[model samples]
Target chain A: MARTAGSHAETTGPKVRAVALRLFARYGYAAVSMRQIAAEVGVQAGALYNYTPDKQGLLMSLMQGHMHDILEARQATSSEGDAVQQLEAFVKFHIGFHLARPEALFVSYMELRNLEPQNFARIEALRRDYENELEGILARGAAEGVFTLDDPKISTLAIISMLNGVVNWFRPDGRLGLGDVEQIYWGMVRRAVGAAE
Target chain B: MARTAGSHAETTGPKVRAVALRLFARYGYAAVSMRQIAAEVGVQAGALYNYTPDKQGLLMSLMQGHMHDILEARQATSSEGDAVQQLEAFVKFHIGFHLARPEALFVSYMELRNLEPQNFARIEALRRDYENELEGILARGAAEGVFTLDDPKISTLAIISMLNGVVNWFRPDGRLGLGDVEQIYWGMVRRAVGAAE
Candidate 1:
């Protein structure tokens, strides 16, 4: 049965998304069932239709929504500055933002293979938008002779890849704090592009 | 029915592993059933047990085998040299070896979470050993004043992460050939650690 429009949905909707993200991250999208998601969300299997039309819809919504959140947060955190300053901000922002939402980051990358063709394309475009943000910085830096780069496109991917690795091993209670991680990664990102001395 | 020792088992064994790797890479380990793997290998589900005891065994074998291959290949491809030369060899060797086995790399990283606890620990230890190889080089370079590194361990993770990103997007027929990619990545890897001019 479809849910009636009221406070119930407003509260239950976010709950459904939260449950789906966790389930997808823990078990790959292909292995998870809508019944499992509904059970986790404390709703009947039939009631899940009120939240998401199908499993594919849930996967796509979670992924696309994650991209939107990333872009929105990135836009808010990023500063208006020169290429070098902007690149540094990006390194710190990428690590902190991703580290805080490991499940989101993990599911987004891991489930891309499961998205339908059109959904995959949409998510890919959003991802490209994010990558372009950094590429723009590298391009400006290269043109201004402030950085040496053979290909800004490749550098953008390399830098992101390097930064993404932080989530895999970083621990707050471990030897290094988030600040130490940010500083170290910022140094590597800056040097990787051959920023001016 | 289980097959007795024969040439059939010898030939079917490798076929089973290859199919399992492909299926696991396509649909994650948890999602891909043993029946699916056996079907892909042109054998009955029961025949799969003759080769591997169960799904968990198959996953562990594939993962552990991949790590062993990485270590064995690293030892063979790595050349005896000073810090700078060895780092170059590592970057090139890593990219070449990984790119050639995209399916194996994909399944190894993605299905790691699904491995049983004991299996996960064994695979992680092997992974750390491989990481120690690069960390040792960075340590040497830092000591010799050939490189500047705030943390050798973090540098190892960063460099591997950066290089690992290559496998996700690289194509043999893409605009850049393998040699061009090796040179480009090596340059970034070198500068990432503050390698001297």
Candidate 2:
């Protein structure tokens, strides 16, 4: 009986998170209640506590999980080659990953202000780690004379900001296919970083 | 007596807007209430309605006012230069304008989802107008061979998105002054659009 209960919890846990993410993305985090999340997950409000401690924990878990998944997915991509190649890979990977998870991307940026101080710090650290990955590529490129940049840190931020905009407007039925959009952005990013062709 | 009443309303109207902007930026629009805004404005909840019809009206007013002010400010700047010069002016202007009014910028993006469908459409139209201003510059630049871009529309969005990021992290007393930040961004924008020497 205990094993069956544990198995049930394991299946229900992900459903709670999925519902929470969608609701939080549609309505800002401050406005969403744990009761509402539980309702959407087809569970009683009391059962939500068994899955997560509270609303804050739900938010932190969703955000931290997103960052972890992003980093893990990035690692799975083929990152072989020079800084230029790696930067291109980073750009393409970021656009594709974020495009597929628009809800997560939206909530990630929109709800950062709602995280508790400690939770905010932890999330920021995780984000900084992801950013530093691209900064490393720019630094490597600049060192090898393959790219010219005044500040790798600012460039990293600028490039990511530019890429993040894709989620705001890209649609599957848009005139430009994903490949076309990626190509255009890749060109602009390469130029922005002053890559030597 | 009527003149005095008119004068009082003129002052109170802006106060109401200022308070609403601050609260909405701190807490997402969905979470803030009319009572809270009125309390912050130091007026009775009913008095708040005299300034704006409802919460939707207030949100729409703030967003529309922001876009109108942006377009008007852009017009006030010297836009008579060539495409490259114009793009540089845009980069500097956007960064300065948005950085100075971080609250409005924050509310503008974060609360966009909370706007009613009609209000959202109107605000988007106004925003598109501002974007087209930049797109016009890029199109002209491409025509004159002063810039190389596959799509002027995408480049306009990319550049604006990148410049918008300055407000996210910029501080008045940071290591980089406003002028320094502008110069660095100008360099990147110039490169991103593929401006020729």
Candidate 3:
């Protein structure tokens, strides 16, 4: 009986998170209920509590998971290049990473207001860590006299925001391929910072 | 009796929209019901239908009203000048206009998924019209040899996304005032298009 329950949890846990993410992305987090998630996951409402304490816990977990995934993915990429190379790598990596997880990206941005204060702070800290990585690149380029920037922090936010906009309209079968987008956007980012061609 | 009914709608119409917008922004659209909107507006749930056919109608109206408001505001601004000057005007106008209506902006982006197919198409058309305005500017600048852009359409979307990002974090009492933000953002916009200093 104990072994059966353990294995059940192991399989059901991922299914619960996946179904919850889809529902939350389709309907905002506040609108999605634990019972609704359980129904979607083919589990009893009581079984959900065994996995997640409540709706808020599930939301926080999803959001934290997304942030951690992105941060870890970013960390895995090589950061050995100069500021311009680093910035380009960052742009492509961000666009590709976000594009691959549209639902997670949507939930991460939209459901932020629903996070508890402590959870919000933790997620925000993780976000800041990501933003700071780009800011550091801009600062290095400016200091090295390779890029001219009015404000590294603002530029960091602006670039990320601009890159994020791609997910809103990009389609796998769209006219422009992802590689084309990366190049065009990298061009704009390079120019935005007054980096020479 | 007719005059009283007309007067009631005239007053209640705006109130309904205001309450609905607030609730939709605070709680996702799917979570908020017609009764909640009516209660907040001090009206009976059935009375809410007098103003809107259904919850979807209210959502459609609010989203449409926002788009029309911005489009009309954009029209009101003078478009006379070189491309660089015109782009500056657009950047400042967009930031100031969106910053003033944070709730509307939030709902406009967040509730887009909740819009019905036809309603989504209409909102998207309005959005494209806005994007076209910026694309025209970039095209003109590129043609006149004042700006260098790899793709005008892509740049249009990118610039708008960057500007729209300000709504996510701008506060009146924050360290920087609106004017300071406009100047900083405008500087980035000017450079992003490869505009000459």
Specify the highest-TM-score model's number: 1
Q: What is the per-residue lDDT of model 3 for residues A17-67, given as tens digits with 9 covering 90 to 100?
A: 999999998878877788899888777788888888888999999999999
Backbone atom clashes (below 3 Å) for every candidate: 0, 0, 0
Tens-digit lDDT string for candidate 1 (A83-119): 9999999889899998888889889888888888899
Candidate 2 Cα deviation (angstroms), residue B16: 2.0
lDDT of 1 by residue, B161-191 (tens): 9998998889889999888889889999988
Query: Where is model 2 more than 4 Å wrong at Cα?
Result: A1-11, B1-8
What order do candidates take by lDDT, descending?
3, 1, 2
What ordering of candidates by TM-score runs from best to worst?
A: 1, 2, 3
lDDT (tens digit, per residue) of candidate 2 on A81-118 = 99999999999899889988988998898899889999
Worst 10-residue stretch by lDDT in candidate 2 chain B? B1-10
Tell me, per candidate, how large a share of the native contacts it keeps: 0.76, 0.71, 0.76
TM-score against native, each model: 0.93, 0.92, 0.90
lDDT of 1 at B83: 93
Which of the numbered candidates is closest to the native, going by highest DockQ? Answer: 1
Best by lDDT: 3
Which candidate order results from sorting by DockQ in descending order? 1, 2, 3
lDDT of 3 at A161: 87
